[model samples]
Target: MNGANLTLEVLKRYGVDTVFGYPGGAIMPLYDALYDSEVKHYLCRHEQGAAFSALGYAKASGKVGVCFATSGPGVTNLITGLADATADSVPVVAITGQVASPLMGTDAFQEIDVVGLSLAVTKHSFQVTEIEELESTLHKAFEIATSGRPGAVIVDIPKDLQLAEASSKPVLVETQELPVAQTDSIEKANQLLRHASKPVLYVGGGVSLGNAVEELRFFVQSTGLPSVSTLKGLGALDPQDHGYLGMIGMHGTKASNLAVQECDLLIAVGARFDDRVTGKLDEFAPRAKVIHFDVDPAEVSKLRPADVTVLGDFKKSLPKLTTEVDFSVWRKKCIELSEETGFKYLANANNPTGNIDPTSMLNELSQLMEQTSVITTDVGQHQMWVAQHMKFAEPRNLLTSGALGTMGFGLPAAIGAQMSRPDDCVIAVSGDGSFMMNVQELGTIKRFNLPVKILLIDNTKLGMVRQWQRLFFDKRFSETDLSDNPDFLQLAQAFDIQAETISQPGEVTGALQRMVKSENAYLLHVRINEDQNVWPLVPPNTANQAMLEG
Candidate 1:
């Protein structure tokens, strides 16, 4: 078998049944092998879309996502997605085709130093020059990506290697073993939980990635502690659960921020103290003694110093720390704060003015959709609205660009989410600015006949940037206006997809219902007020408690 066939076999052995990518000259050999393989290859409009789609697949399915690209620009196009995945800790394996081995350092056409370029963004990378090492290299790449704080991994294979004959049989790769937290450390954490009068649980995306949702839920329930999640950590506990105080951070809920600030003991589970979460680090959780639990030892004490560090898998460690705490008074205070500061959508039901509020539309859509429906979003005010308003029943149901905050992530991510969960409804909530970034992917949706629903919140300006300017920059606005936007409904129709426009308050529910009920791809373009801004935002360099409310 040639190297290309062997590589495909190895991927199949690793249980990768689907991949997303665009074809290029250098990767043609692998494409030829893909033609007859059982693996399904999705042809994305751009390499960035392919990479983000793969990331969405992994985030939604809890499996390693795979993508392919050719040399140079093909590889370069994937950088943003790679960085986004790495920052968010999503497991993805990107395979890129390189020029022939003989062309090394000769500046061949379409040749670039992919290994070096991807070094900082990837968890690990390999450039395979020898045909014999192809299988093992691919195996290691998969293992590295899926294990130990999952992140993107890269394998760059030259064209000659793809064409070269290999005689070795594909071997099964063993999964890497992760370290467990020390027994004494677990005991210490338990002791801390047992003794604290005011304890809070801080959750992050690692809870879902570690498959520790049940463990975390049990920990919160047993302790009767108030819990708050990071943006990526939303849905780790049911949003409806009384224990959950919603997301905590710059745009976090008032209850969560207040709880974090007042707690005497903060149990951080699988969450890093990201700067956004710990605004003005010195003042964050000022009175709290932290018990930080994480799978990555490097993340411990990398930001805020922890009183006690539990270094191991959260799935294993969370179950072991089973001490209950009594914080009923504290919990009551948190619930009261939540009720006082929670987002309140305006009653647009019978408004005389024909303005459709984005928040109200999101709330109505969330109520209408099934509990298992997956929602993806592009980075903007709309993304925050969904995070705050939408109810997610499962951790995997909420997929968005969290760490990197990539704008063009919604539509492609919805494509991947729908592909991964064909029976469930998948919605991509995007802003006008973000939707246009990779709006070309509508073509991919049309070709695949994907039943992905797009909720385009058109405000005719960069909503988040405009809000920042309005609040902090004296409303200078700068280049944030997008008044000349194209007709999005017509754009979707041009891709052979059904489309609808809703500008009035009463039109939202029916339009969303029609879009959701459609058997094929559909787009619902919503015209919202351009001056709308995400509320309860904690301005830059401010304490989380000092949130700016409308």
Candidate 2:
């Protein structure tokens, strides 16, 4: 069998049903093999979108995502997505067709040093010179991506090697399984919790990867410590759960951000303290003693110093930590904070007038979907609104590019989520500007026959930036306005997908129900007033007290 066929076989063995990429000269052989393969290929408009789509697929499916590309520009185009996945620790396998091995360093046409360029952003990368090495290397890439601290892995295969002939070897399993006792970190982490009066459990994307939600829930329930999430960690605990504080960051709810600052002990699990999450690092958690637990040792103390760092998987760490102590005191404190934080039902407050507020729309959407639906959002004020207002009933319910803050993410991500869990409701909420970034994917959704309800919040502007411009830039609108938008209903009709436009608040629920009930892809373009903005924003470089109300 040829190496290209062998590549397809290995991917099938790994249960990879879909791949996202763009074809180029060096990758023609692989594409030739893919023609006969069952693995579906998504020819993205750009390789960067391909990689991001793969990440979205992985996040939605809880499996390693696969993406293919040709060398040089194709590989370079994947750099940002690789960095994004690395930062968020998403499991993805990027297979790039390289120039022939014989002409490797000759600067052959369209050749680039992909392995070197991607090394910093990937767990490990390979350049296959021999056809016999293909299966084993591909196996290793999947293993590295799914095991321990999940991340992007690059497999660079020389074009000639894919066309070379050899008997395909039996399926290869290359990456070693994670060790059993990553629990040492949990035990040490427990000690930090035991002594502290005000302990806060800071969760991250790693918790979702490890499927440690139950254990974290048990630990939080037992300890009664108020918990806050980085954007990536939004659904780590049930959003409506009593102990859960709202999301913490620049656009996060005021309570969670304040809790991070005031807590005496910070127990960070599976989450990196990115600058946005930490705000001004020097001022972040100045009074808090930090205990960090992560599968990747590098993440510990990467941004802020930790009094104790646990280098292990959160699944093992969380369970072990849960068993070690009495959390009665912790629970009381958390309850107190939850009460103090104004963590209440979404419908508790009412805004009866004006254009459809994104926050109100999101709150209503949460009620409509309840715990059964998974919601994804593109980057914008709408993204923040969903994070702030929507109730996440389960882990992984809220998906977004928190670390990368990439726009054009919601639609493809919703497709991926729909593909993964077809029976459940899936919603992709995007701002007008963000939706336009990758609206071409409407065809992708239609072709796949995925029933994803796309909620297009048409504010006719880059709402987040416009808000900042209004507050911080002395109302210099600059390039923030997106006054012109094509009719989304007509756009959906063009793709052969059903769509409806709703302008009034009263019609919001009916529109959602109609879209959600549809058997095929549906788009609901809710025309929000252009000036409506997401509120409770923390203005840049300002004290917490200086937070601007929207």
Candidate 3:
């Protein structure tokens, strides 16, 4: 068999049944092989869309997602998505076609030093120089991407290699045994948990990335610790659990940030102290002794120093850290704080614009969406609103651009997620500005007849930047207005999608219900006031406790 066919065989062996990409000249050989191959490829309008779709598929399904691109611009276009994958630690393998082997350094047409460009964004990048190295390199790409902490990997193959004769069995790369936390460290953490009157469990995206959600839930249940999650860690703990205090960060809940500040013990599991979560580096969790748990040692004590660290797979370490504790008073305090400071959408406490409140609408959406459904969000006020108001059963059920905060992520991610789990409802909740970023992906949805629902929150402005300017920059709102946004309902209709618009407060439920119940692709265009801002925000350089709730 030739290299192109063998490449497909290797992917099939790795259980990669679907991929996303746009075809180009350098990649045409593989595309030709793909015509008759068992693997399925979903053509995206742009290479960036393909990359995000691959990431979304991997994130939503907990499997290695694959994407393909040609040399030069095709490979360059994928950089943002790859950077997002690296930042978020999602497992994805990207294959790019390169100029012929002989054209190296000669600057042939469509030639690019993609391997050099990818180094900053990917866990590893491999450029195949020989047909003999192709199969093993592909296997190694998958292995490195999925092994510790999960990350994106890239493989660049020259056009000549695709036509070169090849012979190699599909070989699997072996992973080193994951380290267990030292017994003394586990004992140290247990001791901290046992004697502390006030302890808070700090969770992060690493919990779900390590496939330790069940283990984390078990530990939380056994200890009954008051818990708070990072943005990416939202669904790792059961949202319905009384102990869970919702997301804790710049735009996190008041109860969560306040509890973390007041706690005596902060048990950080699978979490790095990101600046967004920590606010002011010196003032965060000032009263707490930290127990840090993570798969990567580099992240441990990288920001906030830990009193004790459990480094290894969370599946093993989380179970060992479970301890008996009595913090009934602290738990009651936290619950009271939640009741006092939790989202009061009914009161219209923050915005008085007399328009449909996105917070209330999303809260209702949380109730109406199925437990297994996936909700992807673009970055802005709506993203934070979804994070603040909605509930998720698993981290996979809520796919957001956490670390990278990339715009145009929602729609393509929704496409990938819906393709990955066709039986489950997938919704792309996008802002007017963000929706326009990858509006072309609507073609992919219409072409595939995908049943993905779109919730376009139109406020006629770049909401988040406008909010920051309004509060921090003396209301000098320059270039944030998007009043020129095209008619969304007509745009969806242009793509042959069913569409409707809703602006009144009473129209939210019916629109959501109809979108959820639709068997075909549907768009729910929602209009809201332009001045609304996400509440409970920790202003720049301030402590998490110094939140502005207006």
Looking at candidate 3, what is the lDDT of residue 102? 92
Between 1 and 3, whose lDDT is larger? 3
Give the range of the ten consecutive residues with the poorest summed lDDT in model 3: 345-354
The stretch of ten residues in a row with the least summed lDDT in candidate 2 is 342-351
Q: State the number of backbone clashes in model 3.
A: 0
Pairs of residues at least 3 apart in sequence or in different chains that clash in candidate 3? none
Predicted structure 2, TM vs. truth: 0.92
Ordered by lDDT, highest first, the candidates read: 3, 1, 2
Give per-residue lDDT, candidate 2, residue 187.
67
Tens-digit lDDT track of model 2 for 185-271 = 556766777778777888887788878888888877665668888788877786666667788767766777777777888888888
**Candidate 2 lDDT score relative to the true structure:** 0.79
lDDT assessment of candidate 3: 0.91
User: lDDT of all predictions, in order shown?
Assistant: 0.89, 0.79, 0.91
* Residue lDDT tens for model 1, 1-550: 8888888888888799999999898888999999999999999999999998998888889888899999999999998999999999999999999999999778999999999999999999899978878988998998999898999999999999999998666467788777788999999988887888888999999899889999888877776788999998988986777768898988888889988998989999889899889887889999999999999989899988999999988878888987645678888888888888778877567656788888888888888899889999999999999988888887899999998999999998888888889999989999999999988889889889998999999999999999999999998999999999998877988998888888899887788889878888888988988977787789888889999887
RMSD of 1: 1.2
Root-mean-square deviation of every model: 1.2, 2.8, 1.7
RMSD of 3: 1.7
